[model samples]
Target chain A: MAFDYDKYLRPGKLPHIWCPGCGHGIAMKGLIRAIDACGLEKNNTAIVSGIGCASRLPGYVDFNTLHTAHGRAAAFATGVKMAKPEMNVIVVGGDGDGTAIGGNHFIHACRRNIDMTYVIFNNSIYGMTGGQFSPCTPTGAKASTTVYGNPDPTFDISKLAIGAGATFVARTTAFHATQIDKLIAEGIKHKGMAVIEVLDDCPTTYGRRNKFRSVVDMMKRLKDIAVPVAAASKMTAEQLEGKVLTGVLYKEEKPEYTQQYAKVIAKAQGA
Target chain B: MSSPRVEVIERYCKGCSICVEFCPTKVLEMDAFLVKVAKPEACIACMQCELRCPDFAIKVFKD
Candidate 1:
């Protein structure tokens, strides 16, 4: 059976505003499939996003979407979760939006272990804002701002999330379509905060500057560098240097922040 | 028929050819503007085209 992409998307938003070969579409589809697989009610699900190309995703999806300020998707999502704990809130943003500008909020959200899912569309560079070098841009990669090369190292988003106390963390590229969907579903089902880093492609800005022959070439590159987490376990550190470990990298059951806060309130009120 | 039906939303497809490249069974081909089902019988219902399409322009269904 074919999954109805149109049903979840807003009418007339078809032929999305993304470039011809952008990988954000694949990530969006994975998210929609996850939401469907989780049996989440559209009315009760809230999709929040910060400013960026990936942030534009909320506008296309049919749900209670909040296109919040730049780099503040997690902050807005945090408020939403507290105000309506029953609603499922998911925050979406790009590498620059999430890690660069919203870095503090992101780590705090993970540290709190709030019941929400954060999907970072890490395309290496900031695609929407004219392809500037972002925190996740690999060292020596070229961007509009880094014409010579990006001097700094890239941040491992999944590892950073785990370090910040995210209970569930996973990484997958747009090339691994099925894995993206499966990991997203599992992340949403997890009781505590979950972070799913999607290494998406931006052919227009990032690819052009980075010298990827085409979007297809970039996709092949992503597929080539990805090693399943299980297989990666046996490989030596040297062998896994540049490879991405895709799958649920870290997950542990813990007391969710909102639920714990509610318990505190209940005790104070004696209710 | 047990064969699959491949539909390409012409308005959405920008002729990126990602779908064509990923379709393992060679069931799809690029037209002047968009993708089309060239060999529906060989589709195998794999849905690689639908999943790999960056534009969400293609859909494969067993019909």
Candidate 2:
């Protein structure tokens, strides 16, 4: 079935701001497909995002979208979910917005295990800010901030989400469209907090600094390095050194925060 | 299933060739200014072309 993207997108927001070869659009479409598959009513869904290239997604998506401050998307989305516990709240952000400036909120949201979905477009650089090295930028990759090479270590977002108590977590690249759509839908369906880290491409900024010959080359590299979680389990640590692991990394049943909060309210009311 | 029918909306195509390069069946090709269905019979209806097009220009329909 073909997805009616026009129905989910803002009518006048055609021709987005992304560069010609950017993979953010692919991730956006994957998100739309996921939302459609989950059967969530557009009016009842809230999409929150911070400041950055990937964060601009909410501006184009037709939902109860909130273009929040630089690093406060998760915090804002938390409030949105708390107020309307039945609404589906999803936070969209880039690596810089989600992990660098918003790192604290990101961790707390995961630890809280709130009923929301967080999708991180891990393009590894501050694309909108002239290609500065971001928290998810590879250690040796070059960026505007690191002309020679990035010396700082990168954050494994999926692993971080797992360690921080996210009820559901998954990772997929922009090149894996089907997998991206399926995983995102699964994340939306999960009861508690779900963090899906999508490895997207910033061809104009990250690609230029990192010496990717073309968008196709960068996408091919992403495809080559990604290994499914099931296949990765059998491989030794040395063999899996540089491979990107995809599929659902972890999932567990836990009490959602809002439900617990209701309990507190009940106790206070002497119910 | 029969061969998939590929349609390229020229106005939306940016001539990126992402679809041509990523097509697993090698069914698409890049013309001078836009994409063309060089071998429609080879299309597998994977929808990779439609999903990966940054410009939302191409679409594939399976018969």
Candidate 3:
């Protein structure tokens, strides 16, 4: 059977705003497949996103969604989880929104170990904002703001999540379309904060500026630079150079924030 | 089950050619700016075109 994506998508939302060959669509499809695999109730799931190209994803999906202010998806998602405590909260945003503008909120949410999933589409540049160099942009990458190439170092988003206390951290590229959904589904099933960083492509903004001739070139770049975690472990450091590790990098059991808070409430009520 | 039917929803397709280019089998091709099924008999149901398609234009139906 052909996967009927129309079931999860809303009416008249087809022809999304993303440009041709933008990897966001592939990532979104992965997300839809993951959501379907999880069998989450449509009404019980809340998809939250901050302002960016990737942020627009929630609008197309049939779910309780919130398109919040710039870099505030994590903060808003945290509130949603604290209030309902039962609803599944998922946050999606681009690298700039997650790591630059919303960096503090993102880290804090991870630190709190909230029972939510955050999927960061790290395309390396702020595509919606016209090719601004984001925190995940590789050094010497060209962006509209960085005509001479970016001088700043990049953030390893999965590592950042792990350091900030997220219980699950995974990474995959758009080229690994199937892996994206598997990781996301695992994150949704996890009890604590789970972050999945998907390395995507921005053909119109990031690609054109960075000398990637076409979308295929960008996709090829993602494919070439990715090394699976199992294979990466056996590769020498020199062989692993310039390649990012894909698959679940870190996972652990932790006391989820919601459960911890519930205990506090019970104790306060003398139960 | 027979070889899967590969369909391209033309309206939703942005003519990116990612699916046509990435199909493991030579089952797809470009028709002007849009994509079409060039060699349906060659399709192996790998679903790579459908999965990697940024446009959600491709679908493979297995019997």
Pick by DockQ: which candidate is best? 1
Tens digits of per-residue lDDT, candidate 2, A1-271, equal 2666888998777678888778888999999999999999988999999999989999998999999999999999999999999999999999999999999999999999999999999999999989999989999999999999999988999989999999999999998988888999999999999999999888888998788998899898889989999999899999998998999999999999999999999999999
Per-residue error for B2 in candidate 2, Å, reads 8.2
Q: What are the models' TM-scores? A: 0.97, 0.95, 0.97
lDDT of 1 by residue, A1-271 (tens): 4688788989998888899878898999999999999999999999999999999999999999999899999999999999999999999999999999999999999999999999999998888889899999999999999899999988989989999999999999999998888999999999999999999898999888878898889999999999999999899999998899988899899999999999999999999
Question: What does the lDDT read for residue A259 in candidate 1?
Answer: 97
RMSD of each: 1.2, 1.7, 1.1
The superposed Cα distance between candidate 3 and the true structure at residue A14, in angstroms, equals 0.4
Backbone clash pairs for candidate 2 read none
TM-score of chain A of 1: 0.98
Overall lDDT per candidate, in order of appearance: 0.91, 0.91, 0.93
Residue-pair clashes per candidate: 0, 0, 0
Stretches of candidate 1 exceeding 4 Å from the true structure: none
Give the per-residue lDDT of model 3 (tens digit) for A75-184: 99999999999999999999999999999999999999999999999999889878888999899989999999899988999989999999999999999999999999
lDDT at A38 for candidate 3? 98
Query: What value does the lDDT take at residue A55 in candidate 3?
Result: 100
Candidates, ranked, DockQ: 1, 3, 2
